[model samples]
Target chain A: MSANVKQKRTLLEWVRGYTGQKYITTVLFLLIPIVLLTLFTLIPAVNMVIFSFQERDQLGVNPKWIGLDNYVTLFTDPTYLSTFKNCIYYFFGSFIQLALALLIATILCSKIKFGNLFKGILFFPYMMNGVAVSLIFRRFFQKGDGITNSEGTLNTILALFGLDPVKWLSTPGLVNVCLVFASIWRYIGFDIIMFIGAIQSISPDVYEAADLDGANGWQRFWYIVFPSIRSIVALQLVLAIKGAASVFEIPYIITGGRNDTSTFVIKTIDTAFVYKKVGLGSAMAIVLLLIILIITGIQKLCFRERK
Target chain B: MAENKHYFDLKDYTFKETPKSVRILFQVLKYAFLVVCCLVVIIPLIIVLFGSLKTHDEYIQSNVFALPAVPQFSNYVTAFNQGNVLRGLFNTMIILVISCFGTIITGTMTAFVVQRFNMMFTKVVKAIFLIVALLPSISMQVTVFQIVNKLGLYDNMAAPIIMYIGTDIIAIQIFIQFLDNISVSLDESAILDGCSYPRVYWSIILPMLRPAIATVLVIKFVGIYNDFYTAQLYMPSPKNAVVSTALYTFVGPYGAKWEIIFAGIIICIIPTLVIFLALQKSIYSNLVSGSVKE
Candidate 1:
C-alpha cells in the first residue's frame, strides 16, 4: 500500500514537471482513435454477434430472436458445406507448396551463385499488392485469350506433356485449385525469406561439428537444419492455416464466388451486402469464427514447444 | 579425387580448383528451377503490360502472353479520358495522405499512452487493441456498413479513410514494441525543461521515432493505397471511387473496355508501384531491422 502511493507520487511528479496545460497532451493523443474505434469498430463487432442470434423479416427492418437456428441452417446449407471441402483442398495442397518454398529458401541461402538475384525475383510476386495480382491473373485466365488455351502458358509449356487444358478459374473444382496455386505463388516467397533468416540463425559451429563427425549432407540436414528451423516452420504453418481461412481476395476477385466457387467469406459478404440478409451473414461469420477458433486451438496443440 | 574446386561461397571455406560433375549438375538444376519460378511470377506483370497496349478485341482473341503487334499507346490516354481514372487517382491521394496522417497521430498517441502510462484504463485499451488484430473485419461486414450509414459517412471518401484509421490498431501495436525499446530520457528531459507531455512528444520523442515513422509511412502508404476491399465495399460511386473501384467498373457492363481497364490498372499501379519498386530495398531493410528488433 505504501509502495503504491509512492509510485503514484513519482508519476504525479513527472506529470507536474510538464510546464503548461497539464494532462492536455494525454487527452489529445488518445482522442481520435479512442472515439472512432469505440463507436465504429468495437460497437459494430459486438452488434455483429448479437445480430447473428436474430432473424430479419423481408422488409429488412424487423428482426426476431432465432435461438441459433441460423447456425443450424448454415451447417446444413449445401453451398456452405461445399465451401468447407474446397478449403480443405486448399489447405492440404498448400503444405506441398511450403516444401517448394523451403527448397527455394535453401538454395537462396546456400553458397550457390547469384542467390540474391534469385531471391529478389522469387519475392517479386509478393511485393506487388493483391489488387494487381487479381487483375493481371484475371486477364491471364480469360478463356478466349488462348493464353490459357492448350498452347497457352500452362497448356503448351509447363503441363504440356499430357493432362487436359485445365480451365484455370473457369470450372468450380479447378477454380479453387487454381486460386490456391496463385495464392501459393504470390505469398510463399515471404516464407522463403523468413526461413532463410531461420536457417542463418543456426550456428556454424554446429554444422562444422556435424562435418567433423563425418555426417553426410542428408544426415546434417536431418540432424541440424530441420530441427533448428522448426520454430519458423511452426510459424509458417500457423500462417498457412490462417491464410486458408481468410483467403477472401483471390476468390472474391477471380470468381466473385461465381458458379458455386465461393468460400465462406464470399457467402458472408453476399448475404450481408448484396442480399440484405445481414442476420444470416452474421450467423455465417460466427460459424466461420468458431471454426477458425477450433483450427487455431488445434494448431497451437500441434506446434507447441517440443524442446 | 578431391583436388578440384577453387570457389568458396558465402559460407566461406575454400574449395579445390575445379568443380565435380555432380556439383555442376546440382548448380544447373538450381538455376533452372529459380529461372522457372521467376518467370511464373513475372509473367502476370508482363501480361499486364502487354494487355494494356492491345486493342480490346486483340486482348480477347490474341495471345495475352504475346507481345503486342502495334504497341498501341493510345489505350492509356483513352483510359484516362474515358474512365475518370484521373479523378479516382486524385480522390485516392486525398484519402491516402489524410488517412495516413490521421492513423499516425492516433496510433502513436494511443500506443504511447497504452505502452508508457500506467493507468488502469490504458491497460484495458491495450488489451482491446491487441485483440483487434485477430477480429477479422469481414466478420463484422453488415454492422460496419450499417454503422457507417448511421454515422452519415457512407459512400464518401470519409468512409474508407475513417475505416482505415479506425482499424489501424495492429500497426500501432507494432509501433509500441519499437517505442518500448526507445528510452524515455528525452521525454523526461523535455518535461523537466518545461515542456508538456504533448510538447515533449512533438519536440523530443517524435523526432527520435524516425525509423518507426519511416517504417509506418512506407508500409501504410503501400497497403492502404493498394487496398481493394475497403474501397470496393464502401466507396462505390465513380465520383468518390478509388482506382481499384474505377478499374472494376471499367470492366463492367457499360464498358468491358479491356484496353481502358488495362490502361487504368497500369495508371493506378504507377504511383505506389513505382514508389514500391524504388524503395523496395529501403522498405525491406527497415522491415528486416524492425522485425529483428522485435
Candidate 2:
C-alpha cells in the first residue's frame, strides 16, 4: 500500500514537472485513434503489399515467396482481363450518373416550388441498403417466362408500349447494362446530394448578376456555377473512377458477377475466398489500387493544367 | 382618363411585355421535368411497397406495378419470423450504438489534439491520416480480414464495430473543421480558472460541439446501419447476422416467394426511412455542409 501510494505521487510529480497538464492531455487525446489507425489501416496496407508478392494456398496457409508471378498471371489471364474491361463500362456509367445528378442539382437549385420535397424524395434512395436495392432492382429487371408473360417492371412497361419484352438480366450484352443501371439508381442520388451541396455553396448574387447580363440558363450554369464547383466536380470524378473500379455489392448480389458483370473487386473476392488464391487476389487488389492512384493522379494533372 | 387614373404596375408591365404564355410554358416544362424525375425515383420504391403487400399468388399473377386488391400484412409477420429481423435489429443496434459512440469519442479526441497542438508529432499524425484517407481501403481487405482473424475478432460483433470506428476519416475531418471554428480563448480561460485539460474538454468544449456531434452521430449511424459488405465478410454465422446479411440468407429459403423478400426489404428499410423523414432538415443541411467543407 505504501509503495503504490509513493509510485502514484511520483507519477503525478513527473506529469506536473516535465510535460505539463496540456501536453499530457494532448497525448491522451491522440492515443486511441492513432493506435487504431495504425493497427487497422496502415499495418494492413503494408501487409497487403507484402502478401501480393508471396504465393499462398487456397486456405491462405504455407506462403511461398514468388516475386511478380501473381501479377504476371493477373495480366495474362483472359478472365481477369475481362474483369478489367468490365471496369470501363462502370467508368462510362459513372459519367451518366454524374450528368444526371448535375442536371437534377441545377434544376433543384433554381427558384422552383416544392424544391425541398423533390430533394427529399430523390435523395431517399441514397440511404437504402445495397442488398435491399439489389433485390428490388433484381425483381424490377427479372426476365419473364415468355414474351407475353412479362414479370419484371421494365418488361411490363415495354409490353405496355407494345414492344417485345427484353431479356434484362440474362443476355450477355444487356446484363452489364442492367447492373450499371441498378448502380445508377442506387447511387445517383448520393452524387446529386453532393452536387446540390456544391451548387448551393455558390453565392446567389453571382447568379443574379449573370441574370442581369442576359446570360440565359445554360450560359449561367457554364460560367458561374460549373466553374465554381469545378473542384468538387474533379473530386467527384476521382471518386467516380474509384467507385467504378471497385464496384462490388450491387453486381455481387444481383448477378453474383455472372453474365459478364464481374468487376475488379468482385473478381478479387472470388479469387481470395472462392478459389483460395490469396496471393493472386492480393495482387489484383494491388493492381486495382495502382489503377485508382494513377487515375487520380492523371485527374489531378488535368485539373492543374486546365487551371 | 382611365389609363392616367391607374398607375402602371411593374407586374402588369412585365406580363404585358413578355407573353405570359411562354412563361407559363416554361413553368409547365420545369414542373414536368421535376415530376418525371420524382416518378423515376419513387416508382421502384412504390413497386416494392405494393409488392410486399400482395399475397404470393397475387404477386405472381398480377402485373409488377399492380396494386394489391387485399393487402397482406401477414407477410411482415412471416418475414419477421423467418428473416430473424428482430435478432438482426438487436444485433445491428448493438453495433450502431457502440460504433457511433466509439467513432465520436476517438474522432473528437484526435481532432482536438491535432487541431490544437503545434507539435511535430501531431503534424506527422495528421499527414499520416491524410495519406491513409486517399488510399483505397477496398484493396486492403485481404490483409484486413487476415488481421481480424489473427486477432480472433472474426465472427464477433466487435469485428465490424472495430472496423467501422477505425476506418472513419470523414468524422475526423468534420471534427477538425468544427474545432477550427471554435475560438481557443475558451480553452485558455478555463485553464486560467484552474480547470484541468480534461475538465475543460468536458465542460467547455464538448457542449459547444453539439452540432458537430449530432452530424457525426447521424452520418455514422446511417452508415453502420446500412453496411452489408463488412458485416457479411466478418460475421458469417447466421446467429450473428445483421439486417443485410439476414435478409440475404432469408431470400434463400424463400427464393421463389418475391412477396416475402419484398416484405423483408421493406422491414429493413423502414427504420432508416422514418428517421430520415423525422430529421430531414438537419440531416440535409449537415450533409451539405459536411461535403462542401471537405
Candidate 3:
C-alpha cells in the first residue's frame, strides 16, 4: 500500500512537471491526430497527384514516367466524353432535386399539423444505405413479363393506368433517368432538411412585415424566403455539382456502368481495376478533381459578386 | 330610446389577414403535396418490405401491390444464415465502436488544443484540414488504396477504422466550433487549481462537450454504417467484411432473386431504422445544426 501510494505520488509529480510546459503538452496532443491525418490522408492525396503523371500497373508496380498522355486520351476518348454528358444529366437532376426539396421545405415550414411526421417520413430514405437503395429501386423498376404480369411496383402502377411497362434499366436513354430519379429519391431529404433549417432561422418579423404589406404567399416567398436561403442554396448547388460529377453507387450497382449511365468516378474505377491502367485512372480522377475545384471556385466567385 | 352601441370587431381592426377560402385552399394543397412526397419516399420501401415476405413463385405470380398469400417468415432465417449477416453484424459493431471512440477522442483533443492555443503551427494545421475538407476524397482513393497496401492494412478491419478516424474533417470542424464557444477562462481556472492540462481536459472540458460529442457520434456512426465502397475495397475477405460489404453477398449470390435480396436489405436496415426512429429528434436537429451552422 505504501509503495502504491508513493508510485501514484511520483506519477502525479511527473504529470505536474509535464504540465508546467503547457505549450509542449499542447503540441503533443495535436501531434498525434495530425500525424495520422498526414499519413493516411495528406500523403495519399499528394501521391495521387504524383501517380497521375507516372505510368503504373493496377498494383502500382513498375512505374514508367508518362507525362500528359493520360489526360489527352481521357479528354479525347469517346466513352469518357459520354460520361461527361451523363454528368450533365445528373446536374440537371440536382436542380430538380433542389427545387422539389425547397417546395416541400417551404410547405412544411408553414403552419401545419403533423409537420414532424411529414419531415420524418420524407427524411427516412436519406438514412438508407446506398447499396440497399439501389436494390430497392432495382426491384421497384423491374419490368413485367406480360401486360398483366406484376414484375415490379412501377409496372403494376403502369398497368393500372392501361399503359405499357417502361424499360427502366434496359433502355440506353432511360437508364440514366432512372438512376437520376433514384439519386433524387435518396438525397432530396437532406436538402429539404437543410432548407428547412435555413428557413426557420430567418426571423419571423420579416414575414410579419411582409404580411402587413399585403404580400401574397408567392410574393412573400419570392422576396423574403428566397433571399434568406441564398447562401444555403449556393452551397447545395456546389455540392450537387460535386455529387453529379462523382456519382457511382447507383449506376455501378444497378447497371454495372452499362447503358449510358457510367459516371466519371465509375469510369475511373473501371480504368484502374478492370483495365489495370492505374496511371490512366489516376489521371482521370485528377481531372475530375480539378474540374470540381474550378466549378467550386466559380461558384464562390459568383456568390461573392452577388454579395 | 338609447342609441344601440355597435361593438368594434377585432378582426376588422387588425391588419388584413389571408382570406379564409384562400387559406383553406393553401392548406388543402399543402397536405396534398406532402402526401405525394411521403408516398414517393415510402412506397418503394413498403414494396421492398412486402416483397421480402413473398416466395419466388408468388413474387412472379402476384402483382407487387398484392399481399403475399402466406408470408415467408423463413426468408429472414435463411438470409441471416446464408448471407453471413450475423458475422457481418458482429464485425461491423466492432469497427463502429472502435472508430466512433477514436473519432471522438482525436476530434475533441485536436479541437481543444487548437482552440486553446494561439500558435502558428496550430493555425497551419487548421488550414491544412480546411483545404482537405474542400478536396474530393473519392478522387484520391486510388492512391489511398495503394497506401493501405503499402502499410499492409489492406484486407484488415483496422484499415477502414483507421481511415474513418483519420479522414473525418467534419467532426473536427464541429468540435472546434463547440470549443470556441466554451470560454477559455474555464481552462485557466483548472490550471490555476493545480490541475494538469490533460486532467483539465478530462475533468473540465470533456464533460461540457456532451452535446457536440453526441452529434459527432451519431453522424460518424451512421456514415460508417452506410458506407459500402470503402469496406468493399479495403476489407474484401469474408472474415473481415463489415455490414455493408457482407450485404453485397446477397446481390452477387442471389442475383435476380428479388425476394432474398429484399430480405437481406431489410435485415441490414432494421437496426439503423430503429435507432433513427428512436433518436429522430436529436439526430435530425443535430444534422440540421451541423449543416446550417456552417
- lDDT value for model 2: 0.82
Sorted by DockQ, highest first, which candidate order results? 2, 1, 3
DockQ of each: 0.38, 0.39, 0.36
TM-score of chain B of each: 0.87, 0.92, 0.92
lDDT of 3 by residue, A225-283 (tens): 78889999989988898889888888888788987788889888888877878888888
Task: List the lowest-lDDT window of 10 residues for candidate 3 chain A.
Answer: A144-153
- Model 2 spans > 4 angstroms off: A1-14, A58-60, A146-150, A211-214, A299-307, B1-19
Candidate 3 per-residue C-alpha lDDT over B112-143 given as tens digits, one digit per residue, 9 for 90 to 100: 87777777877888888877876677767877
In angstroms, the error of model 1 at B116 is 1.0
Instruction: Report, to 2 decimal places, the DockQ of model 2.
Output: 0.39
- Evaluated against the true structure, the overall lDDT of model 1 is 0.71
- State each model's CA lDDT, in order: 0.71, 0.82, 0.82
Candidate 3 local lDDT, residue A77: 80
Residue A166 accuracy (lDDT) in model 1: 53
Question: Which one is best on lDDT?
Answer: 3
* Pairs that clash in candidate 1: B4-B16, B4-B17, B4-B18, B5-B16, B5-B17, B5-B18, B6-B16
Model 3 ranges with Cα > 4 A deviation: A1-20, A146-150, A302-307, B1-22
